[model samples]
Each structure stands twice: as structure tokens, then as C-alpha cells.
Target: MSVLDTRCVNQLYLTLSNILSISESDLRQYVIDKKFELLDIAWSEIDIDEFFKTVKSNVNRLKGNIIESVTISHLSSRLEYECNKENIYNLYSALTGETKLRKYLSDVGIECIHESDVISVFFHGERIDWKQYEQTPVVLMLQKRLGVTSSGDKCINGFLFSGDIHKNMNVTHIARIPEFLENLLRILKVHEAIYFWERNAQPYEIIFKEKFSGIIYDGDDSLSLEDKNIKTIKHCISFLGRNLFNEWNQNDNPIIRLKDDNDVLADQIISSRNLKTNRIIFK
Candidate 1:
């Protein structure tokens, strides 16, 4: 079990955040515009003072309406019990003042273990090595952080750090989106529907039974237009209708990485037994 300390929680959050290619600074701007929020932490990152002030004005009166005001003796027990209950994270978010995110994380069943010294996260699925792949985005960032070659079928990566080497860059396989378009594939039941997206090229057709299509463009389609992305993705999913969007929103994101209880990255550590290492290593 991992503790909910600064390093662990932030690492976990970053690993799972969907805007893989986007940097934290860029994402923060979206937070400023209230396009989407990162619950509480995003506000802290941009301006700690302003965030606290906002919270004080909007939240102070609810001091007694939350778990924070409860007696300390029952805090630990209550938290543990809630953590064990299904979607009890809703309670945690209510306490933390971030209900939507709490609902989201709860659906995924990812939880932190601050109650024990080992301080770890637990998942319902035990098959993949999630912890290892969780940090791949950081590695992806490294390739851009410093100049590195990414020729051949390899991608330049920089997630691993050595006590001697600030970063260890390598050309490796990008994790193949651990889970396939399972949710979208479910849409296969209705073949008449087209796909849709807010960005990127999307497949116009499915492989008959394979379910869910990819970007439909051949060697010559634009993959970065906001409207085009939406159209392309819409082509891939038009069969499901608007409620499907909520399904996408409500669908619990399963573990898309390898999960190892012992691995930690700050000490320049990594688990070599991940999906990318075994099957996706470019060279």
C-alpha cells in the first residue's frame, strides 16, 4: 500500500490524466479558464494564495459540514471504512470539496494507502504491471526535454533517472494503449453509426467484427483540426447517439498500466517487466 504523500499522489494523478501529450502548464491554462478543473490541486499550482482565498470565501462556513471537523479519534476508522465501501470516494471528495473528481476516481476503483507505511495504491484488476507504465508520460516528456534521436521504430524517452545520470534516454516502444477500444468496440453492436471526436483523425470504418475504428485517413488526412477531429471521431461513433457521450464520461477507466507494489520512481527505479518492455521495446 502506498501512502498519499506528495510524491506518490502527484505521480499517480499525472500518470492517469488523459492529456498525455500536453504539458502541465498548458493544462493549467484550461484550469484558469475553467474549461475543466483538476479538483483542488490545479488551483494550488497556479496561485496558492488566491486558491486558498477562494476556498475560504466559498468553503469556510461548511467547516462543520465536513469530515475535517469530525473528532480525530474516528477519522482514521471512518476513512478506512469509506475507502472499503463501493464508491466511498464520493464521501472523500465531498469532504475535500471536489465531488466530480471523487465520483470519477471512485468509478475507477483506484485508491491510495496512506494508512500503512508501505503507502501504495490498490486496483481491482491484478493482471498488468500498472505502476511501471504509469510514468511513461514523464519518459515521453524527456525525449522532448533534451535532444535525443528517435529514428527507426523507436521513440526517444526520458522517464528513468539514475543517481549519476539526470535522465536516461532511450528509444523504446510507446505503450500500445494497454486497453483497446473496448468501450467503443461495444458500440459495434450498431454498425450504422459514425465516429466523432473533439480532436485528431478517427477511423471511418470498423474491421467488420473487430469493433471500433481508428483514424480513417490514409497517408493524407488532416489529424489535428478541432472540427475535423470531431467529425472523424463522430464517424467512428455516430451510431450510439448523444447518451453515448455520457457513457464515455461515466465509463470507469480500467487500469491501463502495469501494477507493481514495490516499484518507486524517485529513487531512479523502474519495473522492467512491463508490457512496453517485453512487447513494445523498439530496439
Candidate 2:
């Protein structure tokens, strides 16, 4: 009895098509097959609108299934050599064009503040409060300006302005493409570490904690990584990765330690209890 937003379905179709490089007919056939196999229903039984409503309701799960299928079919190496530090940065550079990363981010309405080893990113301009307007138009315009057509390119413009992917809500802090990509790549690395740990049959919590001791900590004595959930730990890792990317260039060793300033900013953003006080906080 609930109405579904057709636009969400359309965008998901386009996104999957772009990501998989499949034609519309092929995608349609694939969906039909999937529905038959999973739901045990003929495609003719349901109206197209109802089918799209189902997809909209389960978009995240569908996306995950597709990604897992792709990974199983093609990415045998997984994150080992493919997702190395160099390769990730190269992909970032390629998406951002020839201009420097900071400059490209600034051009697309992101403000970067560099203080010592820390680099803080925020949404800039007069309209600091983005909660008032609808987010789809804002996201579409920003994506056009940033030339974000490929799924390979990180497109977090919606979440940058609005707090969530549905683009119906707002947040105090927001991050554009760079931070989104950084967080994604860092999570990939964490997955790599998890794979390694699992394959080696290593002890669970203690050794895993040792591997990421200093990198995940934000210099806050009270807030400990050991006490945090996997999601929070991944976020902290991405924060560290972003700071490291800003401070060190391609030629530097990728395993450098986080400096004092980086820890200070991390403490302010991640450890600070204030989450909903709108005013350009970290994403």
C-alpha cells in the first residue's frame, strides 16, 4: 500500500547499468531471472511498478548481492594487489582530473582546512544549512559540475549535503568525493586485514587490536578503539587514512604514523560527543 519513488528505481537501474556495463535489455532479463529464482513468481504476475517498488524497498540488499556476485566471478585476487595504496590513489587522481586533489575538491564546493598534519574537509558557502531544500537537485548539479558519471567515481554528494543516501535528511558535518573515497578505500583495507587474519587462523580480538593500535586511536584517553564496534573502527581508520593522504605524497612510505595534530583533529571530530549540532562537521 506504500508508494515507491520511481526516481530511486530509475537511478538504481542506471547505476547498476553503468557499474556493470550492461545494456538495458540484458539488465531487464537478469532482473526477471532473479525475481523468478528468488521469489518463485513469474515476471508476468507482478506489474512493473510493483516490481520497482520491491527493488526500491530492498535497494541496499540488492546492491550488496550484485557486488558480491561480481567479486566472486572476477575478483579472485580480491583486495590483495588490486586495492593497494598506490592503486587507490591513482584511481582517485584519475577521477579528480589533472588538477590537484585539494583544488578539485574546492572547485566543487568543498572547503579544506589544513592545520599541521590534519586536513579537515567541510561543505562551504553561504547556504551552510542544507536541510531546508530538497537534496536531489543539489546532488545532481554537483555531480554534473564534478563530472561524476562513472560508478567508479565516488559520488557521495547526496550524503555530503544530506546525512543519508535517501537524501531526505541533513547532518552537521559533510564530506564530498574525497572523504567518501578515502573512507571506502580504508574500509577495503580493513577487509583485506580481516581476510588475512581469517586465513591465517589468528587469534581474534587481541592480535587484531595490536595490528591497528596507534592508527585507530584519536588521542582521547577515554574513548578506546577496543570498546568500539566494527563500524566505528572502520571510520577511525578512514580518518587516519585521510590525514595520511594529505600529509604524505605518493613517494612517501605508506605506513607512516599519525602526528600530534592529526590526533587532535580526530579527537575533536570522532571522539567529541556532539553529533547533531549542524555546522560543518566530518562525515
The top-ranked prediction according to lDDT is 2
Poorest 10 consecutive residues by lDDT, candidate 2: 68-77
Q: List runs of model 2 lying over 4 Å from the truth.
A: 1-99, 109-127, 133-260, 263-283
Residue-level lDDT tens digits of model 2 in 152-228: 33211111001112112221112122334333223223344333322432110000001123232223334344332
For candidate 2, what is the total of clashing residue pairs? 1
Tens digit of lDDT per residue, candidate 1, span 1-283? Answer: 1111111223322321221233434333333443233332221134423433432323232232111100000000111111221221212122123443333323455333322222223444432233344345543332222122131111111111111111112111112110111121122221121121112111110000000121122222433333322332122121112122332221111101111121112222111112211221111
lDDT of 2 at 48: 37
The alpha-carbon deviation from the true structure for residue 99 of candidate 2, after best TM-score superposition, in angstroms, is 9.8
Question: What is the lDDT for 236 in model 2?
Answer: 21
